[model samples]
Target: MTDIVLLGAGGHARSVLAALALSGDRVRGYLAPVASDRLLGIEHLGGDDVLDAFDPEDVAIVVALGSTSSTALRRTLHIDAVSRGFTIATVVHPRAFVDPSVVLPPGVQVLAGSIVNAGARIGEGALINSGAIVEHDSVVGAHAHIAPGAVLAGDVTIGEGAHIGLGSRIVQGVTVGSGGVVGAGAVVITDVPAQTTVVGVPARPIEDKRMRNDA
Candidate 1:
């Protein structure tokens, strides 16, 4: 079993720990100076700076930070760890249903109750949250997040760093662009542009409308 150094110590980090435990990967400890000193009785291993202490070959790293809209921080951490000769580990919860034909990239995390169907390709550092569904032939881009209970029908494509909000539904063939955010419970039938936020029954852009008082 490979030893791991987990980054982050938030709720997502806890989830990652559970998933890692369920998958039987040994965790050395977690980093993140701002977080609590211990999680589930596991002692803190200092901050990101501590990565320098461990030989990269001896400890594989995994980031447990969940993306919201921007993947900048998560991406930066992953890349930095790799550049320093640390291996980025992949963790899939035993409860996740990933098809035999599906391919998941390094640093990917598939939490409990997630379903990734055949022919689906999950990109690097992507997080498929609990109870999320990625139907046949769907593509999840790097660092993108399918929030809890979100559903993506067959052939759907989610771009990099995009966030499909909790319980949102995406119809087949729809593409959510990079950095796009679909709000909770939105039903998306049309393509969502990059860096935009959409919400509502059929999903429309939440334009920043400035209301002005009469002059």
Candidate 2:
């Protein structure tokens, strides 16, 4: 088992820890700026400023911070961790099936039983929840979330920061614009405009903008 360090101790961090535990990896500790509380029986080691206090060569890190609208903050954390000489481990559940030809960038997490088919390109920080199926030649943009049990067929394009709700079914070759939201159990058969929110079978616009202003 690989000994790992988590960068945050919030709810999302806990979920990542649970996933790691499920995968039988060892979590050495966590580093956070505040909230010194223990997480999942693990101790809070210290803050980001205490990076120099630990031996960087011994710890591989996973930046387990949850989704935030601020791209700058996420980039800063990734850059700083890389500069600190820590190997940033990509956390994928053991049960997730990723094809050999699929390209998954750093910080991507595929939960249990998720199937990423051939030629799919999943960008950095994307989350593929349990049982989601990303079909062949699909392109999932950076920071996109395919919720549990969602089915995205072949050649689909999911734009940056978009969220495809649980059990949603997206047909082949459809494009979901940047920051779009497809509601739970939706059947998306057509292209979604950027920053829009769509729901129901044969998804129609609920919110005009594809990106949520406060997301």
Candidate 3:
């Protein structure tokens, strides 16, 4: 069993810990700015600086950070850890169903109740949160997040760093571009442009009120 260090200590970290427990992996400890009361009984290894004490080759890291709006911080943490020679741990909850043909790269997290179907390719550091459904042939990009209950129909392509909000549904063959944000419960039927935020049924781009005011 590999020694694992979690990078964050919040709700997401707790969830990851639960999954790790089922896998019977050795959890060395967790790192955070301060100790979390919720993580009682688990060793709190101080902040990011504590990573220096452990040789990267002997320890792997799981980014246990959750994101609602952006994946920048999570991506940065993954990159930094790899640069320091630490390997990222791929986590799949025991309750999650990942098809045999699905290719999960390093640092991917498939939480409880998630279903990744046949031919799906999950990129590095991507998150498939609880109850999310990634259908056949879907491509989830690096550091992207498929929030809880989000459903990506067959052949849906999620770009790098995109966030598919909770309960959102992407129609078959739809492509969500890089850095895009799909608001909760939105039903996407068209291609979402890169760096755009879309909301509402039949998801459309959010009009920036600040841009309108400036104009």
lDDT of 2 by residue, 46-110 (tens): 89888767666777788777542233354467668878776777888888899999877877888
TM-score of 3: 0.95
Write down the lDDT of every candidate, Cα atoms only. 0.88, 0.81, 0.93
The alpha-carbon RMSD values of the candidates against the true structure, listed in the order shown, are 4.0, 3.5, 2.4
Candidate 1 lDDT over 44-126, as tens digits, reads 88899878999987899999888655566888899999899988998899999999998778899899999999999899988
**Worst window of 10 by summed lDDT in candidate 3:** 206-215
| Candidate 1 ranges beyond 4 A from true positions | 35-38, 208-215
Off by over 4 Å in 2: 10-12, 32-38, 46-56, 65-87, 208-215
- How many angstroms is residue 41 displaced in model 1 relative to the true structure, after the best TM-score fit? 1.3
- 157: Cα error in model 2, Å: 0.8
Q: How accurate is candidate 3 locally (lDDT)?
A: 0.93
List pairs with backbone clashes in candidate 1: none
State candidate 1's TM-score. 0.93
For model 2, state the Cα shift of residue 180 in Å. 1.6
